[model samples]
Target: MPQIFRIVPYSIYFWSNESDPLEPIHVHISEGRATSNATKIWITSTGKTVIKVLGENPG
Candidate 1:
């Protein structure tokens, strides 16, 4: 995993292998070590952000 940045107890990163279908340009955020169900933040071409909370309770 490539870490983009960290804030407090969270890590924002991207999986090197990525997903099979390949999501758009996105990053995952999670507490401590990154998880498979980490929240995904997608970046649109227009510079808008779309957040997807995997599993549950990513807050």
Candidate 2:
């Protein structure tokens, strides 16, 4: 399981367990319920957007 950092109103923050699997390490961002619709991004190489959805419209 992943570890949560902070959860703001706009976004939810989480630590990556995929640093070894995917270099640069990353955090998970979710908007609504479930992490399915969340966007995964690289913490080191952010701003370019490398998001991968866990699912579709999990609202």
Error of 2 at 22 (Å): 7.7
Quote each prediction's TM-score. Answer: 0.85, 0.40
lDDT score, candidate 2: 0.55
Q: Against the true structure, whose TM-score is highest?
A: 1
Tens-place lDDT digits, model 2, residues 1-59: 35465464335556445445655655666654436446777654445656666655444
Position 2, candidate 1: lDDT: 88
**Number of clashing pairs per prediction, in order:** 0, 0
RMSD to native, candidate 1: 2.2
| Alpha-carbon lDDT, every model | 0.86, 0.55
Output the TM-score of candidate 1.
Answer: 0.85
Per-residue lDDT over 1-59 for candidate 1, one digit per residue giving the tens place of the 0 to 100 score: 88989997889999876878877899999988888898899999999999999864344
